[model samples]
Target: MDRNLIVTMNAGSSSLRCAVFERGSDSPDPLLRLSLRGLPEAMIWERKDERSGESLEEELTPPKVDSDAQAVALAEMKDRLLAEVASERIAAFSHRVVHGGRDHTAPVIATEEVMTDLDALSPLAPSHQPHNLAVIRDLSSGFPGIPQVACFDTSFHRDLAQVDRVFALPRDLSEEGIVRYGFHGLSYDHVATALDDLAPELSGGRVVVAHLGHGVSMCALRNGISVATTMGMTALDGLPMGRRPGSLDPGVVLYLIEERGMAPAQVREMLYDRCGLLGLSGISSDMNVLIQSDAPEAREAVEFFVYRCQREIGSLTAALGGIDALVLTGGLGEHVPDIRARICGGLGWLGVEIDHGANDAGETRISAPEARVPVFMIPTDEESVLARDAETVLED
Candidate 1:
């Protein structure tokens, strides 16, 4: 059987997730999945074979040399993949690029010109765009002849209303692309599709999806299209994330520069790396870790996260006039029931009633039977979106 496989890569600042899907299937399942976490200092590599139902995990420490640790890991991953499946059977490589700017509103075949355009948008998404493009470059070098597809996380929100996208900045700056461009769109797209399949009735109504992972954002969808989102200009906007501060006043940046004498680079680093849950808790940024800790700071951090999510949900509900359904996705949203409960708990005014038993059991439909607004916990499948987009680019 010569299976044409599509390999999808989603790279983050300190992690990489890769999945292999057989092309041309009505609904394809990942034949093999690989994840690399805790990059640089230490690496944990895990592989799961869906066909054989086997899983393997190991820890690795890359050499202390100056070369990029993630690139080295990708090379090792390519070797393992080639060992199991011939490179000739692979059809294409798809990537989840964070910033598409204005030119890329849809998936495009990776080329020198496309890469150059994408590289210029790096400052817009400093923490993610560089890593995303680096992986694309590595795969382009390693796979040589394979078609590379660039899937944008910003594509889904490209059609947002003018009022929602523009900032209060000067017209020249907005024209230069300082407008709001929401992120985590790949995840939101997957969830929207899942909602249509799971509950077609609600899919066409007003809905709000809370993507609560390491990178957090919320979107308001009416009739399954993005109307408004919490993120603006960059991922640093919207709900607080694992490390990035969610929303901040413009004055704070000026104060850091003028009064505190912090360099622009230092401010950027603090905004992207040292804030949010870590800054709030003065500890680890992982929600799982914070949930386990008994410290007051940890408790406060979790509380602040929940509070922000609840506030955003209310804001999105208002944007939609009223929400008929609510969806929780991403890492923390899917796995952490306590967080979900706490978030929904405050949404009583919005008619979001949680069935405690259902929520605790991790059921997909967690809303109470008589609740006005239905709530669902849908696990996001971004790799599947990447694979679908890659196949489309190949067929074109």
Candidate 2:
């Protein structure tokens, strides 16, 4: 068996991303990548050979696939991999679990009891937790004896000051695990480690990393550790995202229930799938689409997103006592120049200045020469982090 091979899986609501890495003594080299997205008519499967940088895209016929989405997708992925390489090469399966609750503050082997306890925490991360667990369970059932390590997204923030993790509620409720536990930690951890190589001088200084994607959140890093973050309690509590309404006033929720007579389920649906940029623009949840649109509503949505990001940057800056460097990662953070420029424009007073030419050119360091605080665009490597963690757990 190729014991050095590790498979890392990231299960989303409608898609699954998996990567294969060949681990060596130094670091792992990525082998292949796969993404499966469920569509109305059929499933769209995409695969990339990192070695050759060649990609293949195809649609899976429904008649040949199982009705269960997770089962069919995993089966198809297995078939494709076996066709290219032997199954014995796969050493272990690593999963990106969204919530680790209060106790699972590190990666652990997914035993039956562990899975049951993790499944119980799904209500806290309705959109993500279930899907993540589904993949882990499926792999466990399929591979049987092969170890599956659950690397939690919340584990990175386990060291948050008790004051930061506390809630303004009854002590009983607070002690019942109803406290701030940030998400997107795997992504943030990748960025945190990359900072030293990306900008050595600023790596040890105060840095705020913005992981903006369909699920958006910002983290404040002091000396490469999470001191504060935008996400709290759940993924939905962070900055406004593709569909989630972020940082909503609790009274609005009470009003929806007591005054409007809306059920909790309906309110939950609205908050998780009907709000954010989609609700604001009545357009696409995609930032690219919103940026290209001339509609005033679209402009307003984009403006509001930028405004919120700017506000959070200020808050994180306060948490750090000051700002030294700002690093943007993830889809929207790395690619959308206009959004980054807009977010940084309002922060010029804090010695933040973007080099328009470099920013537009998509350079790694986009800060102006005279700018006191440097800005960087670093792509996150969550799968690599998962693979490394899984390997470590397996070795242990």
Candidate 3:
């Protein structure tokens, strides 16, 4: 209700996080600082303990998650967020929308038609779009007077070279929204800003940013510009994640549809739900679990994840012309020492040497002292980015 407060929301497929930000005391710059943060229903699907040994699939339970239950879940997620920010008068609400289609490249105030346009992109991000719009719909109606902003994840790739943004298909298909649009952009931008703040020299260098979590991707940045990324077109098209299958053969998808007689819905469900670590391990999707499992599938899952990361790093390095540093961010990137080491192993040709002791201890700098390319563990702060965007966009 006042000039000092705003709400920032990051709505993922299974989880939604929110933060409240308030202006500094009489700061004429119109800048904002974080106030509070919360993650309501993170990993709503039932998950086996990651630390648990492999061959424990029986412990899995339906997390009581319904695929189409976005409306109610969003209402509850927002209610909890509002309760968390109860003391502050929220001036505006901001969200992390995965796809902005083509027009928007910056945070923009959401209008009725804008919501409709974004909704049309559900096919592009079936696992993410509905829940994203659901949060906006419920929250917008709930707080009629508060302004809502859609901060796009795809916006960051708008400046990507045309070669990196388009497909080799016909012009009509390429123009029909079937081009490359990268995701996890909000987190990557935060990585760039964090690096600039704490390690200025490294931020401008050829940097490969690994954003590993339940869902994962890698981006190659030269001076904070995205030259290439692992994910393209859809979030499902990246490195293998918890339940999402990333980068599979197009023929496999067709075989499942045409030969196996799998309906589109069933195929989508398998790709978005049953695949990845879960399908690969025949156990759980949780990284901690796969790391602990003694089963061969579990080992394969971990190996597959790290191996692809290495392969992608090479591709990203080629895009950057060379890598000067590597940043491991997001949930998995911050704490998983072995995973980070495994990924960097194949990159030895690129002159990246890891300090096992530092990495194992979760040190911010994981590279050896003599290593040419610096490796950092910077925890991404998307809420802070959203808060900054909210303040910037809502200012008079």
lDDT order of candidates, top first? 1, 2, 3
Estimate, for each residue in 1-396, the C-alpha lDDT of model 2 and write its tens digit.
556678889987767788888867454547888888853236788989877889999887742443666667667767776676666777889999999998799999999889988999999999889888888887788788678899999999999998888888999998998999998999999998889877777888899999998899999998899999889998888689989889999999999999999999999999999999999999988899999999999999999999999999999999999989999988898889998899999999889999999999999899999999999989888998999899889878
Q: Give a tens-digit lDDT track for model 3, residues 127-188.
A: 78877888888778878878889898887777888888887889898887788989888999
Pull out the clashing pairs in model 3. 50-288, 50-289, 54-293
- Candidate 2's error at 193, in angstroms? 0.6
Where's the lowest-lDDT run of ten residues in candidate 2? Answer: 62-71
Predict model 3's lDDT versus the native. 0.79
Q: Model 2, stretches more than 4 Å misplaced?
A: 25-27, 38-43, 59-71
RMSD of 3: 6.2
TM-score of each: 0.96, 0.95, 0.88
The deviation in Å at residue 200 for candidate 1 is: 0.3
Candidate 1: tens digits of C-alpha lDDT, residues 1-396: 463999899888878888999876665569888988887777788999867889999987763578787777777777777877788888899999999999899999989999999999999899889888988888889778888899999999999999999998899999988898898999999999999999999999999999999999999999889999999888999888899999999899999999999999999999999999999999988999999999999999999999999999999999899999999999998999999999999999999999999999999999999999999999999999999999888888
Candidate 1 Cα deviation (angstroms), residue 169:
1.3
For candidate 2, report its TM-score: 0.95
For residue 132, give model 3's deviation from the true position in Å: 1.0
